[model samples]
Target: MNELISPKYQMKLAADVEKAVWDEFGSYKNVRNYIEKWYEHDEQNYNWENFRVVIRDDKNIDLNATIHSMPGEILLKVAIDLGVDTPDFIPSIPTFKNEIKSEYKTAYDTFTKAYKQIESDPSTAIGLANSALESIIKEILKDKRLKSKIKGNETLYQLSSAILKEFNFSSTEHPKEIKTIGNSLLTANQAIEKLRSEKTNFHGKTNEDFLIEDALYAHFIVNSVATVGLFLNKFYKTKYPKSEPEIEEDDILPF
Candidate 1:
């Protein structure tokens, strides 16, 4: 007896097929044609707007909770039944579970949204990514009882500085690792600000100026921000109850 492919693998294969069709067609309308090749209804539109309109009518829809996945996996089986060859392409969707503090869950939710929309809506992805980072910083500051020190509304710069400021690492003998991580955080922060101010969905443009490559770069930077934010989240854990916040860079060995 031949072995049957698992359902998860079958879905993965479907995504690969859809990805191939997307790469080849390079247009949503054509992709829709590939999707509904043997459509029963002449009025069936596979456009994103039409899909959204259909999903909106659901009575028990959960909008706040985000599902980190994409569309077009079903197209794979249909294409296969039509004798279309499925290409081997791996999806770059990230899969990770975040068990964060209750106060920080909102930040994590935004992070989830950022990842969910990274490939489709690049501008929204970047904005949500920055918001997640900012939310995490605010949570950290609130935890540390340092919010009182800053008066008035704080910008992303201030939020970033709140984390990077007065850290007991610069003067340390081997602060290279910490320095590198700090620089990554700082670079991501600055890039998020620049990207939001110039491009993102926050402003007037309807993502007309944004491209997929730009979204890819934004995704990379946004993930970089989360990397630093989570590091800070864990780093502050030592000072949760009474202990002072400390820096313990593991790879700080002397030459």
Candidate 2:
């Protein structure tokens, strides 16, 4: 059997196919149809198992985790590996393709910026990193609530405390930390109540007794805030069309 095509080659093929369909049909529907036909035609000889195989399972792929690899590299690698052919005439691989690229670019840029913040501006980085950790903790809490696993709250709380300390917040050992947690908690009780009423899954177990002690640790370490901030910005802009995104740019390396 032939060796699996490299990701770059796959992308070139996909791009070529897209270009041809665009020249012939000029719309996404037509392009998709052409792709479908191409796939169907090639299915008899094609080996589909090459790219989709889970070579090494990475924990960061989990949805609840706050930090994960930026999607640009993943998509680029997948595209190249799949080697979907695009025709030369297609102007761009349709709006959807552009949108995915744009989203990935934003994520890549944000991570790069956060990394710079850590080296040049520690205080800002701390805030960004802490916020991300807190958000992860909230997500863990929410998931636990849905699963009727609120008994794990103490663990979550301890994890959150440690995460906060890592971001240069107050001491995890202090008694007042509990009070602080109550005050600075990211997810609102009201929202959880609303979810309980509307979402069948939320009502399974409805108590906040447990703390997700290791949640943040499970997701990220030093740059938690920047990661979370990037997510929040993207999510808010997408959800609230009226609000314009505030672009955050840090000092670029002279090189």
Q: Across residues 119-142, which tens digit of lDDT does each residue of candidate 2 receive? A: 234333333333333344444334
Report residue 225 deviation for candidate 2 (angstroms): 8.9
Tens digit per residue, CA lDDT, model 1, 170-209: 5466469977767666676877777876777676665367
Question: Which 10-residue span in candidate 2 carries the lowest summed lDDT?
Answer: 59-68
Per-candidate local distance difference test: 0.55, 0.35
Off by over 4 Å in 2: 1-113, 144-255
Model 1 C-alpha lDDT versus the unseen true structure: 0.55
Per-model TM against the reference: 0.53, 0.19
- Angstrom error of the Cα, residue 212, model 2: value is 28
Total backbone collisions for each predicted model: 0, 38
Worst 10 residues of 1 by lDDT: 61-70
